[model samples]
Target: MNPAKVALVTALAGGLSIGAALLGERWIDPEGGGIPLAGLGQGEPVQWPEIRLPDLAGHEHSSDTWSGHPLILNFWAAWCPPCLEELPRLERFAQRHADAGIRVVAIAVDRPEATRAFLAAHPVDLTILLAELETITLTRRLGNRVEGLPFTVAFDARGRHVFSHLGALEQDQFEQLAARLDAPSATPR
Candidate 1:
């Protein structure tokens, strides 16, 4: 790839990593068992719970669409500066990985009007899901009661939890994520 392409990918991964990490993690409700992702040394497969939310265009998004692929589910809000800074990188990540069977899904945690206004000014190509009333329920169910926006959760091809970063992502970090796209291929079918 050209320098620009390389730089772009690096930025996407790094931006997401940084922004999300700076936001840090929300302590999961002890009552709510957190879904284990990485740094746990947990050998179990990742599980992506079913989520149904509206898209920016008012269309419903079935989280199952991301099934059978490495899903990079990102959470953000328009009021969030880090998220706004990382939009383009995330969009580019989605485009390049479209053919790689990896999906980048952005869930807007803001209200409809705010989300609409943000989308209007900064159009993006990724499927922007709305974390509406239903999403709130799902977030709680997913052990995100403390609710940290600008979070990036990666799931394996089988919908198993892989890894997650809680801040802005840079290009290198993103490539590491993209590397996951090739991970399943290493396993026996």
Candidate 2:
């Protein structure tokens, strides 16, 4: 083939490969990380999905059951180091804020055995619910289409989303969140 023809073919192939990767990423992560607070209105009330799943002990519960209390819902997996590191902090935060009507709920997107084993080695007081592999869709519903581990979403007493974050959270961040949760609730719209 002529040198010019070879260069043209290579450029076209490279462009096609880049396009495919971008499309795939978008398909998998609709929310992506570009907009952390996208789709959620500021101070606007939005109803969260009714997430029903079983606790480590097998008791069933739903997200609505935690209504009237500020909730910090965290999606984690046993295999993720960051998720494991943040579990204890979340547990302590939940205990400290129990009197303030704040609850921390952890949803594990891992096999039951794996989650149980991890908990056994590193115990926590916060309720750990099993979402297993279904957590991919469940996290997306909670505005975490990036599917990153240790993602957290905070809801006000009215069950409206107040904050969301991806990646590991530091102690100070948790403290800040606790303060926000303890604040007076705004009138639901």
Candidate 3:
């Protein structure tokens, strides 16, 4: 084969590969992370799914444990930088709002050992749940299309999803959500 012909073929192959990858990212995995169809049901009012995840102590707990309270579910992982950065803020918020009947739960989307080690090093007041394999699916159902870490979903006392955010939440944002939950119109009966 001629040298020029070989170069042309190689260039075409490279271009085709790049195009395929871009298409895959755009269509199959919109989150850009490898999980297919991430965030598929985002922005919908999905009732809290029935969850049975374990804590650091290996004891299983049901989602109903926090029922009848304004709940905040934060999906995080030990390897995610934003998740680690926002934990302290979340802990402070949880501590301050404990008396308000608002519950903050941090669901670790990582290995049990990894979550335990991370929590041991950086203790938090938030209830920590471990759900390694089910994290993606659970988060997607709760309106996290990107399947990204530090995803948060807020639920009313009746277990209705009221709000969701995909990135690190600031203290002020947490305060605003808490205020909304405390409003006369928003309060549960």
Measured by lDDT, the strongest candidate is 3
Where is the poorest 10-residue window by lDDT in model 3? 31-40
User: Cα deviation of 166 in candidate 2 (Å)?
Assistant: 0.9
Where model 3 places Cα greater than 4 Å from the true spot, the runs are: 1-44
Question: How many backbone clashes does every candidate have?
Answer: 30, 0, 2
List where candidate 1 sits over 4 angstroms from the true fold: 1-46, 134-145, 185-188
For model 2 the local lDDT of residue 171 reads 76
lDDT of 2 by residue, 1-189 (tens): 569746854664465456445543433325442323424424546555578899999999888788777888888887777888888888888888898888789998777998999999988888889985566776666655455667788888887776766666777778877776667662233
RMSD of each: 10.8, 10.7, 10.9
Quote the RMSD, in angstroms, for model 3.
Answer: 10.9
lDDT of 3: 0.75
Q: Considering every candidate listed, which one attains the maximal TM-score?
A: 3
Candidate 1, overall lDDT? 0.68
Error of 1 at 173 (Å): 1.1
Q: How far is candidate 1 from the true structure (C-alpha RMSD, Å)?
A: 10.8
Stretches of candidate 2 off by over 4 Å are 1-45, 186-189
Write one digit per residue (lDDT tens) for candidate 1, span 59-113. Answer: 8878777666778888888877778888788998889889987888899888788
lDDT values for all models: 0.68, 0.72, 0.75
Better-scoring candidate (TM-score), 1 or 2:
2
